[model samples]
Target chain A: MVLLEFSMSPLGKGESVSKYVSRSLDIIDKSGVDYRLNPMGTVLEGEWDEVMAVVKKCYMRMRKDCNRVSCSIKIDYRKGPKGRLSSKVSSVESQLKRKLKV
Target chain B: MVLLEFSMSPLGKGESVSKYVSRSLDIIDKSGVDYRLNPMGTVLEGEWDEVMAVVKKCYMRMRKDCNRVSCSIKIDYRKGPKGRLSSKVSSVESQLKRKLKV
Candidate 1:
């Protein structure tokens, strides 16, 4: 599962996140990789190689076209027996459990 | 780094994918989990815990509130030297390279 999150000024304000997402989505669509974007509309998918190449393209396009741009990419591991949790959270119930235990 | 791809019928079509995405985004936001959604508005983020529980919630909510629901999830590893690639593609240049190399 290769997940890429690129946050930057869009190349064209008239340009859409969906369009950029589609750039990646097009790869995913053909790769038969199951994927969908976020609401603010970034791209996410599962693949086994060279996901950063796509991110690099996004950066290049945005840099060449957008006025100002900054982006970061995060890739994670989620499979097998340990796929249950995303992380430890600050939930009230969890907090209570910890505090009560303490 | 954990990647989760959930392609399920959303809870409320009239409610909006952004809304459901926002729910996950809310958790992500609090977790400092950086994420953005797809254009159609699904959720994507980076985290290192039990993400499936969240998906479980979405499923439960959609099942109760929406008409019908189906969901599939994908998780992968992309956070190391190997993270550089998503996968091999059937590109012309790559094919050309193969044939030329041969």
Candidate 2:
């Protein structure tokens, strides 16, 4: 499975870009990829096509309304099973042996 | 100031939930606030009202199309100036003095 972490926002969109970010997310929603929203970016878990396609669509959609868009992406592609979404966090928590406070 | 990290999704969606998540993000975008998109959840930086307002809107908007929605939220409220977004991460990086790979 491929795990992708990414943030996309339009440049010169003022102090807050939640509105534009929301539109980009619409594209991701229609792409049919499993995703978890995070504090920094959204984590997408799927095959290469499913994950990259969503990222590509988000960038494309943002371009229509905003002149410049900034995207930060980090991808972890593994040739193994799925369900790493929760498992990865669980593993880290297990090592700490304490529930994450937040 | 207030910092919020959250994930919102519709229950009973298939394995992939990009679409629903995207819709939720739309509400967040319209909210006039500062935010960062992360791998686990989107982080919003603002006063209590601004931050929570966005969360409230996202939850409300998502309920329109999704029968059941799940949300995870974490907040860090501090009495200080703005700009914790990069500073928080930068502080950690400074401690290690090693650049984050991704």
Candidate 3:
């Protein structure tokens, strides 16, 4: 499974980006892929192409109105592992000997 | 190399998390490892242990003062390759036939 976390924002769109972000999330919601939206960014779980397609759509959506957009993406492409979204955190929590709410 | 993108926020600490995040960044800045600070989260680049240590320190730092802390971490562990920070985006831009400022 491949997990992607990304943050995209429009330049000169001011501080609050909830409206634009919601529009992007709307696209993701319709993509039929599993995802989680956090305060920092959105985590997408799927194949590499599936995830990147969503990101591309989001960037295009923001670019329609905003002149410049900044996107930061971190990808975890695990070849033979699935259900890593929660397992990754479990690994960390096990190491720390504490349970995380994430 | 391992690239970790994570956002940590103290729950019930109000809307702004810059202060708490600054403390976390201070720990990272002193870790002698390469890192980047963005609006959404911080990216740390290093070995697995090195990156996780910084995250542990940040979590502990926030846990000291805040009862509940939410941390969202996305890790990209690439083996036998380096300088992925820029290259990853380059690959995407190449596929899209457009350049991204990130």
Clashes of 1: 30
lDDT (Cα, tens digit) per residue for candidate 3, span A1-102: 788888787879875555676677778767887776553467788899899999999999899999989888877566776676566544444554544333
The TM-scores, one per candidate, come to: 0.31, 0.52, 0.52
What C-alpha lDDT, on a 0 to 100 scale, does residue A52 get in candidate 2? 87
What 10-residue stretch in candidate 1 chain A is worst by lDDT?
A: A83-92
The list of candidate 1 runs beyond 4 A from truth reads A1-102, B11-32, B40-49, B79-102
- The C-alpha stretches of model 2 lying farther than 4 A from their native spots are B1-102
Query: For candidate 3 chain B, which ten residues in a row score worst on lDDT?
Result: B93-102
Q: For candidate 1, lDDT tens digit of each residue in B12-66?
A: 4753343444444444334443332332223433553655666666666556666
RMSD of 1: 17.0
lDDT score at residue B102, model 2, on the 0-100 scale: 22
C-alpha lDDT of all candidate models, in order = 0.42, 0.69, 0.72
How much native contact recovery, as a fraction, does model 2 achieve? 0.08
Name the top DockQ candidate.
2
